[model samples]
Target: MTTSPNAPMTSPTRRDITAETGLPYVPPGTIPAPASAYDGLPRDTAVAGDRGWDRDSELSQMSKAVIATVFGLALLIAAFAVIGRLGGWAADYGTILVYLAFFLWMSIAGRVFWWGADTLIAEIRKKSNTGDCR
Candidate 1:
């Protein structure tokens, strides 16, 4: 049999391809299935629920955490300044520098803690909502 130049090819469409491959067929403007669909998957990071903090609430909490961190840093700086006025050579410059470094470490640690807690709680909430939490 001869094929016409204008004839549509017999090759399978994308839906057919996915069906044969056991993969999902994603339509345009639709979110694809998350990685958690395969095996014993990790939780999705995008979902937030009423059990913990919602997205906006999480952002607000993070903002507050950052503010508290900065406040703690400012207190350290003030303490160093007061120690400098007390005529301690170690506190005059070196202590301030060291405290600055320590403040950075503390801020980073706090951020990590807050982020981990938020993620954990959010995942728990998501699982609960989806009826996956046991």
Candidate 2:
């Protein structure tokens, strides 16, 4: 059979395709079957009843930021100690340079830590709301 070129094309139904191809047919936009009843649950349910800190909470995020900042400070101190031992720069400049460096480090680190915490909290909120934490 022939059809006119101007005719509108029609999509075949699942039954039509299955009959023609002798294979199981899945309609377009059909969602796949879930593996288990739990598969449909929200991702946050894993920690729903827990008494511990919520991983996505602002307090938890801020604690993480504090820990990270402390770790950075430790590294900065270690680096300064190593430099002092190798070049004696600290001895020449005394505590003044150390204070200045510490002030600068705290200022920059504070900003970075807050920014990181804010970003992480926002992402967690977005994922939670969208049910796409995974």
Candidate 3:
């Protein structure tokens, strides 16, 4: 019943599936099952093993921390800039300067910290011949 984008398309009928599988087609709605199958089950067994740090979490602790810090700094700087403008000493150049000084510094610091820490740790692990990343 599946076709590639360039393939000639044909509407799939139950006959098509039955022909492919050589078994009678039982439509999904016809299946009898409880509404909450495996309800209350833990998603996965609680197990720990050598799932390495180099390949585990979607984002490492350092990465999440760095992103959060940069985002927070950006928010704080923008808020302060707006407040400054509202306080009657508004200069476009001043706001820009504040942004450059604070946000730019924070962003650079975050990138540097994440990169430096990760590289340093990786290098250390490489020297020690302990990290199995390939």
Tens-digit lDDT track of model 3 for 6-31: 99867889989889989998868997
Instruction: Identify the runs in model 1 with alpha carbons over 4 angstroms from their true place.
Output: 1-93
Please report how far candidate 1 places residue 17 from its true position, in Å.
54
| lDDT (tens digit, per residue) of candidate 2 on 17-106 | 889999997665797765864566675677445555455665765466557656666656665665535335556677678667766766
Best model number under lDDT: 2
**Candidate order by lDDT, highest to lowest?**
2, 1, 3
1 versus 2: better TM-score goes to: 2
Report the lDDT tens digits of candidate 1 across residue range 16-131: 88989998777677986566433453433443432533455456543554565566556556655665444454466687776676567556656655555565567668778999
Give RMSD (Å) of candidate 1 vs. truth: 18.1
lDDT of each: 0.62, 0.67, 0.61
Q: Provide TM-scores for the models.
A: 0.32, 0.33, 0.27
TM-score of 2: 0.33
Ranking by TM-score: 2, 1, 3
Counting clashing residue pairs in each candidate, in order, gives 0, 0, 0
